[model samples]
Target: MGGGGTLFTYINKSTSHLIIPFEIAFKYEEKGFKTADAFIAAYTEWVGADVLVTENRHFLACHLDLPFKVLTAGKCLNLI
Candidate 1:
């Protein structure tokens, strides 16, 4: 399996992860992040995750003071 396959498997296995509250995601949206991006970011913070793995450049480029680190999937895999 390749990176994409590994990532897909990892995500599928994380289906048991907790869902973030709407209020938390809404707060991120108010900070100017897109809907999905806001939700992802909110969940990462709410879970106290060490890092956020995503390819969304806009989310990564944001200058917001996020508690968790945002990284590309490749970077995340390297760390793992």
Candidate 2:
């Protein structure tokens, strides 16, 4: 996940027409996990994008707190 974030940052900075897809990991069903909104919230703040896509259903439900639209699936082709 760290690698994906790093790559996204690099690609976004390097290319002018690149849309970076960021993954928000939710440890909701995992042990000792309280919040499943960390990654989405952080990335929304970090990138300031217009939209965010995730496969997790809980993320979409809790996306009202975020600035971007939490989509289920979308295209983000990295030219870099």
Model 2 misplacement above 4 A: 1-36, 74-80
Candidate lDDT (C-alpha), each:
0.75, 0.49
lDDT (tens digit, per residue) of candidate 1 on 1-80:
56654332233336447667899999888888889888888877776676777899987788458887778989887865
Cα RMSD, each candidate: 6.2, 11.9
Pairs in clash, predicted candidate 2: none
Model 2 collision count:
0
Query: Which pairs clash inside model 1?
Result: none
How high is each candidate's TM-score? 0.68, 0.43
| Candidate 2 accuracy as lDDT | 0.49
Across 1-80, the per-residue lDDT of candidate 2 in tens digits comes to 45545324321654444432343434322322235456445445556666665677666655365556666664444322
State each candidate's clash count: 0, 0
